[model samples]
Target: MEWLARVMGARRAIEVGTFTGYSALCLARGLGPQGRLLCLDINEDWTHVARTYWRKAGVADRIALRLGPAATTLATLPQEPGFDLGFIDADKENGRLYYEEVLARLRPGGVLILDNVLWGGKVVERRQHPGDTSLQAICELNDFAAADERVQPAFLPLGDGLLLLRKR
Candidate 1:
């Protein structure tokens, strides 16, 4: 993720799920000196630890952590394209919603990465359970990205699958 941001020369980024700040740290390090990162997550306890790590890494000044439902936080931002990079690793049930919201805010040529698209291989199961909304949502997201013309997508089979979508 850090490599992607650095390669893209991202100056503005947003992360939908920041668990203990590991990914955020990588992203902040990749961003330019004047770059800014907005982190949205609900757990204060975990984010507290993330803050400590960010401070230790000397990137705390560039990151703003928002504690709340990610959807609400995202909705508060302007709808126009602004963000240069985005990472989504939050609730699976709302995968499509987050994708739409984030993609709408991503500038052309920006990258939006969605993690855990494979759901531990459940996505490829022979017979999917009807009640697994997370799996259903992920499958829907994969199909949507494949057919969506707004972006070019590369679905990597890396750990649990990472879908990298570059906006056109």
Candidate 2:
């Protein structure tokens, strides 16, 4: 992610599922000086831990965290001079919605990475069942992204899976 940011020369970014902020730190550090990152996550406890590390890493001021539903928080962000990248790894059910919102706000040629897309390989299981909600959600989101015309999409065989989309 840091490499991607550097390659794109990205100065503004947002992360939908901050978790422990490891990804955020990587993104923030890559932004370097005169850049800003917004982190959206619902868990206060985990974010607290992230804040501590961000301070130690000296990137705390570069990142602003919001604690709430990612969609709700993303709506609060402005559209102009939009984000260069978006990393999604939050609630599986709302992954598609988050992708749509982020895509709309991302600048041209920007990227959006949806993580855990393979769902431990359940996405391609022979007897895939609807009972596996996360798997179903990932399948649906993957289909939507592939079929969408606004962005060029590619799937990477990484940990679980990664769906990379670059907005046209």
Candidate 3:
């Protein structure tokens, strides 16, 4: 994750799910001194843990954590396209909506990273619980991204699966 951000020279980043802030720390390490990271999550306990680590990592100043529904926070952001990179790992049912919002905010050369697209390989299975809305949403998002020409999309078989979308 840090490598991708560094290689892309990302100065601004947004992360939708910050469970303990591990990924946020990784992404923050790539930011320039003046860069910023906006982290959104609904779990206060989890973000508390993240705050501790962010301070320990000396990146607390660069990170701004918003505790609430990610969609609500994203909606409040200016629509004039501001981010250079974004990562979405929140509720699967709203994955496409999150993607649309993030993509619209991303600069022309920015990137959006979507996690759990493979759902631990269950995505290719014949049977799945209707309650597994995240998996269904991820599958739909993958298909949608692949068909969309505004971005170059690819699914990487990493932990679970990661969908990389780079805006054209």
Candidate 4:
């Protein structure tokens, strides 16, 4: 993630699910000295630990933490394409919605990455477990993104799965 940000010369980025702020740290370090990262998460406990680590890493000044529902927070931002990079690792049920919101805000030629896309390989299972909303959402997103013309999609099997979309 850090390499991607730096290679793309990202100055403004946003992360939708900042669990412990590790990803945020990587992004903050990748960004230029004057760059900024917006972190949105609903859990204060996790974010507190993230904050401590960010401070320790000396990147706290470059990141802004917003505590609330990620979707709601995203909706409040202006409709312009303001982000050079985006990472989404939040609630599974709202995965597609988050993707849409983030992709809409991604600048031309920007990158948007969605984590846990394979959902432990359940996305391609022959028979899915009943009520497995996460699996369903991931499969739907994979198909939607691949068919969408606004971005070029690449699925990497790193970790569970990393879906990368470069906006056209």
Model 3 weakest lDDT span, ten residues long? 126-135
Tens-digit lDDT track of model 1 for 33-92: 799999999999999999999999999999999999999988999999889999999998
Q: Sort by TM-score, best first.
A: 4, 1, 3, 2
lDDT score for candidate 4 against the true structure: 0.92
| Model 2 lDDT on a 0 to 1 scale | 0.88
> Candidate 3 overall Cα lDDT vs. reference?
0.90
lDDT of 3 by residue, 45-70 (tens): 99999999999999889899999999
- TM-score per prediction, in order, is 0.96, 0.95, 0.96, 0.97
Candidate 2, residues 87-135: lDDT per residue as tens digits?
9989998888888888888999999889998888888881557687777
Q: What are the lDDT scores of the predictions, listed in order? A: 0.93, 0.88, 0.90, 0.92
lDDT of 3 at 146: 89
Worst 10 residues of 2 by lDDT: 126-135
Off by over 4 Å in 1: none
Q: Ranking under lDDT, best-scoring first?
A: 1, 4, 3, 2
Q: What is the lDDT of residue 66 in candidate 2?
A: 91
